[model samples]
Target: MQANIGTIDRALRVVAGILLIALSLFGVIGLWGWIGVVPLATGLFSFCPAYRLLGLSTCKRCQ
Candidate 1:
């Protein structure tokens, strides 16, 4: 799939994902922290199925 996520969006996702996973590892959060993987994967792939389904794109070119 084409990259629908922009640089800033991807960076934020990566950061948020890392923080969530770190909190989980440190026992600061419950298993829900594992949910961070979703953002991490989408960030790396630069494609969000939800965004597609909603007809949204963050990439400048895509717009």
Candidate 2:
């Protein structure tokens, strides 16, 4: 899939994802922390299914 997520958004997602995972690992949060995988995967893959469904594209070069 094309990258509909921009650089800043991707970075934020990655950071948030990592933070959530870390929190879970450290027992600062519960199983919900696993949800971080969503953002992490989307950030790493540069694609978000929800964004596609919403018809949003933040990519600098989208065709």
Candidate 3:
């Protein structure tokens, strides 16, 4: 599969994921906060199935 995510987007995902996980861990937020796992996974993997299905790409160099 092609890489469709941009560097800045990936970086934001990673940062948001970390924040969500941290808040969830602290019990200040609900379990739903753990949903950050999605961004975390996608950020690490550098691929988003939804983006692929929707024909959306944020890559700087798409071909």
> Tens digits of per-residue lDDT for model 1 on 1-63?
988998899999998999999999999998899999999999999999999999989989777
Identify the superior model by lDDT, candidate 1 or candidate 3. Answer: 1
Over the full model, what C-alpha lDDT does candidate 1 score relative to the true structure? 0.91
Residue 50 displacement (Å), model 2: 0.4
Provide backbone clash counts, one per model: 0, 0, 0
Model 1, TM vs. native: 0.93
For each candidate, the alpha-carbon lDDT, in order, equals 0.91, 0.91, 0.88
Model 1 stretches astray by more than 4 angstroms: none
- List the RMSD of every prediction in angstroms: 0.8, 0.9, 1.0
Please write out the lDDT profile of model 3 over residues 15-53, one tens digit for every residue: 999899989999989798899999998888888899999
TM-score (all chains, Cα) for each model: 0.93, 0.93, 0.91
Show model 3 residue runs off by greater than 4 Å: none
lDDT of 2 by residue, 1-63 (tens): 788999999999999999999899888998899899999999999999999999997878773
